[model samples]
Target: MSERVVPEDSRQRRRPTKQGAVLSEGLIVETALRLIAQHGADALSVRRLGAALGADPTALYRYFRNTDALLLAVADEMIGRAQEGWTPTGDWRTDLRAMGLRIHACYQSNPRAAALAAHRTTGRPHEKRAVERILGILRSAGFPDALAVRIYHAFVDQALAFAAQDAAALALPAAAQEKEAEVWNAVYGKLSADTHPHIAATFPLLAADMRESGYPFALELMLGAVAALRPERRNS
Candidate 1:
């Protein structure tokens, strides 16, 4: 069989698929996200995407180098969604909190994709813009250059790490998730003070804590630490 070649013009404008649907990078990513959300990340193969978009599977190569490239694009789109319509309030801590929460929520909403792609570094516009905004927030808040970079690095990593962790839990099967959620009450709730004094005493707190995400509390702790490092705060 002769190897098929993509026309250069096809790259310059939106290409119509065999089923007559227009194809663009944005369309591909959006379609991929919806399919993944509905059917899980394993449903994101080029063949499936092509079928969904009514395009040749090879046509996706025009926009992405390979499956990983497409996955990165999807990941970047998640970041872009988290950033949509958000403006920094000029208060560094508040802005960071909002950014962190937005990112976590975006990932949780697409647990399968987030579980698969959260660790990927997509050097795309959305990721780059997020990095730029975070650095700018820290730098403008009186953090020294090196300090700002360090804090920005930690902040981004922390957000991604929590997103991945929470998304992993959410990605589990419904039955498995329900069983896991019950462990705190089923196991820990039975511990007696005579056998495990500390745990028994804190079981109420532990049960509440275990049922929810710890990201918000962790975010606040990080922001409080950063607050103490701000030059103005330190000098004052």
Candidate 2:
């Protein structure tokens, strides 16, 4: 028979870390997020996490089975924070816009963690609640089950894809970020009109629009499509 593992809470009660600080799963996740924010996602290792927490690296295993498990917890925390104060307005479109923006803002604010976990499915409490909320919004808006699920997939994935893309940009080193930021002026902005007439014609507009994250614009388009597919519209 395999050895039975002890529960995390029981373990936590038994011993504090070497620095005399108590280690809870919440504290560990918080420290990991801080480490990622300061040093980038690549800096997240059990050893580094332990050092930051003043704990034995082995002690971390008592709470999380592995780094992946801790990552899921951290990912779930992102969802939790995003959903913390959110309430659906009576209007489904407005609620969705609010939710999509809230999640994007949360991810943008913690780009290092977002870059690492944006595509993750945590199967944790916060993720479960978010899934429920989105489905609830669609269903309550009169979408049939199949259609609602389909739209949910597109909406959530689009938000995450945009978040990850934006986060990757945010996560770049300072020098790389500056080079990318200068591309509009240094490369596209200087293209000969004869060679790239269309781009030249729109260069002023493109320059202003391209500087921001595309999530909000993409989100509006998505919401418009979803509105078109609403059950009432289809039935009419």
Candidate 3:
């Protein structure tokens, strides 16, 4: 049998969980996400993260200077996850739509993290790769460089903005979530037809349609407008 090699230098500085499991950046991020999901986004703190990991709070500082760094990591991980297995079909419209939906799903998957990091920058490797990939898609569609960049900005910003809004709702407390739903049914759906004829006319369909995601519908509107702008792609 061969002698076992030990990571003495690396292992020396590693932290451990209460159960003796070794701590890692990935585990910390995963635990942090769970804590955010369990508590509210506003409740994320170094102390809470340490507790979740069963390690001293200071231990996290070894990997992250502070909660903001951790948040950045979480945000990058979310984006990385979103980009996984994402192979383009070369059809700009179809591919862009798929990518938008993926981005939306990623944000909603980790609502609290999404809300916190939406306005923040994640200059990590995965984020950079994602940006390059998106720009390539727009370029491949035959959009002029400047115009492609503009559309890229609009497409990304629109997706994230809507995702953030949708995620904020998902992160609301159970009672709050229920309350919002009740408003759709008991409030908006019940408006007086005379006082609000337009809303009243659509009120019947409101509850059902309202329960579904607005991202896809809004995405198509954006794509259609973009197609119109592209003379070559207008028919496409």
Candidate 4:
């Protein structure tokens, strides 16, 4: 009987070397982040990332214990990007608004990364700094320490959640996204005049505002509500 021989490349696929591993972790993470951003978190896998990196599947374990850990890292990296060059000007409202918008913009830039990081807390340095800065702004605005923390939590959580939802909606395939818009237009455009007089009357303004702005309007509304609840204003 003739002995069977495995292909050289097939054998090489089973093992990876540490040489030139400097770029391996970063490359894997970047590629995974891109894939996740484009395809959603469920689309990522160590094996797939390795294949994308042209390394052994086991090669990724050197940097990430598993996919979850790598995801956390990606989340941290995205937050870090959001916080790059951030500096507070000491005006609590302006500072907080800037911070909120910056973080929101970061998610907007990469919806996939935002979706993955949305509900997952890494407690990474950047995340900690963001929390501290937000809490500081609230406290500076005369919120009680405890209340400031609570408000900060509410603000960040809501902002991130909304960002994630927006990202997911935006990430939909073009056809599906257009279909959603068409459905909205159809439903709103065809509201019966008599049965929905109030809604019908306001439909033009609503549609105009919807076309002009979506999340920014909501973010502004949220900030206005939070500002109205400021302790200094309440005391005055």
Rank candidates by TM-score, best first: 2, 1, 3, 4
Which portions of model 4 miss their true places by more than 4 Å?
A: 1-21, 233-236
TM match of model 4 to true structure: 0.83
What digit string (tens of lDDT, one per residue) describes model 2 on residues 114-219? 9989999999999999999999988888899999999999999998899889988998999999999899989999999999999999999998998899899899
Worst 10 residues of 2 by lDDT: 1-10
| Model 3, span 1-236: residue lDDT tens | 11234343443335468968788888888887887777756445777777777888666666675667778888888888888889999888988998899999999998887888776669998789888988898888888899888998999899889889999999888899999888987888778989989899988687888887888999999999888777575345
Q: 3 or 4: which has the higher TM-score?
A: 3
TM-score of each model, paired residue for residue: 0.92, 0.92, 0.87, 0.83
Q: Is candidate 2 or candidate 3 better by TM-score?
A: 2
The lDDT of each candidate is 0.87, 0.87, 0.81, 0.73
Error of 3 at 214 (Å): 1.2
Name the best candidate (by TM-score): 2
Point out the higher-scoring one by TM-score: 1 or 2: 2
How high a TM-score does candidate 1 get?
Answer: 0.92
Compare candidates 1 and 3 on lDDT and give the better one.
Answer: 1
Q: What is candidate 4's lDDT per residue for 101-139, written digit by digit as tens?
A: 777888888887887777889977778878777887788
Backbone steric clashes in candidate 2, count: 0
